[model samples]
Target: MEKQLRKQVTALALYQIIGGILGILLTLWVMFRGELVLTQQVLRFSLFAAALFMFSILCGRMLFRNPPRGLVLSLLHQVLQVVYFTFGEYGFQYVAGLRIGFGFDMVGSWTFKFRVALSSFQFDFGNATGQKFIGINLVALFLIFWIERLLEQGKR
Candidate 1:
């Protein structure tokens, strides 16, 4: 792997690890605090969140150990965040939505960082029930692209 590619992988790995830790912490806080009753829906959501965070940490570890697999996992993870997915009290639906060319996201009370920009940070808080979230996460998309390009170059 090239120096540039190595650095990007390291950065992504760190990001994933840190984000996973923070998410776990936040989910715990939300659960313990009793902000919402522990219903099947909420419990399911919490379990899913925890599982996803753990998966992210695993992806980060994989990235550090194996770039090819790591890059693919990271790409899948980012694609998941971009894809249209929703879990609500009424029911859970994970279909129908794709944002290409630009970035935008709409989420409810469950708040998380919607990464935007290649080398920058944008943070938004959630407070409204019916909120329309708009964000840009070109960073994840571009980083995976650049990493793949670098890997291809290295192969040649």
Candidate 2:
């Protein structure tokens, strides 16, 4: 890699690692923050999510090695962030069609990096019910793809 790209990847690695840590910490806080009691099922799910975050942190560290394997793992980390599910809280009648939205939620406040969207564009920083969403972490994806592109350019 070129010097400039090296610096960029280094920065991105740091960001990814920090994001993983933040994701874990935030999930923990949210898990126990409210007065609502956690069911056994929810606790199990939270534990699983924590494990995934920990793995993501490991993937971020691999980016520091800058090996071919590192690139693969880093990309996998980003892909793992992608999620698929329906809110199913309420039906959308105003759009009258399937309204798939791309947006950012609370930045791993309740969940980890998720990249699941369809056709709409939006940014959600608040608590919205039926129409809102927890979409992809475009930042993470953009950084990884940028690094890949820079690496290819360096190869040239």
Candidate 3:
């Protein structure tokens, strides 16, 4: 059980680390391409990525000291992902519509049109392009959860 918990924590840590590296790289790339200015959005995303990396390390340490039950950790991860997706960089209204495809606007639209509109969020990122960082992180979380489930089943 401790090994499994450690594996889960490691998965989260990888997510954070990868996100941070990618965020930094993209920011630098944009700066080089444009006026070499660091906008507030870019700075916010960079800081958020750094914070996530730190949080991941802290969670790993805490798990080593006192491991949580698998279900509890899973629930906590899910809740955190939900909060991040809803209120993080991309903003609630946008990501929710992209993820669930059940927003108010979707109700009256044709199925195909709704799908297109929902998928558009991938490119739109609403008013803030930097919000794409959160959206990508959300996708990474989904993949991590799926991978974790697979690993758990393998153990069983």
Tell me the tens digit of each residue's lDDT in model 2 across 1-156: 667767766765675667667667766777788964797756765676666667666766886775455666766665544332334242111110122324433433554443332221121222255442344345445655875775576567
Q: Rank the candidates by TM-score, best first.
A: 1, 2, 3
The C-alpha stretches of model 1 lying farther than 4 A from their native spots are 84-136
Sliding window of 10 residues with minimal summed lDDT for model 3: 114-123
Candidate 1 RMSD to the correct structure: 7.9
lDDT of 1 by residue, 45-105 (tens): 7787777777777878898998888877876766545423322222221111122324233
| Candidate 2 Cα deviation (angstroms), residue 101 | 7.5
Count backbone clashes in candidate 1.
Answer: 1
User: Per-residue lDDT of 39-86 in model 3, one digit per residue for the tens?
Assistant: 676566545544443443344444445444433343353344332222
Better of 1 and 2 by lDDT: 1
User: Could you tell me which 10 consecutive residues in candidate 1 have the lowest summed lDDT?
Assistant: 89-98
What's the TM for model 3? Answer: 0.37
Model 3, position 17, has a per-residue lDDT of: 41
Computed on alpha carbons, the lDDT of every model, listed in order, comes to 0.57, 0.52, 0.41
TM-score of each: 0.64, 0.61, 0.37
The predicted structure with the larger TM-score, 2 or 3, is 2
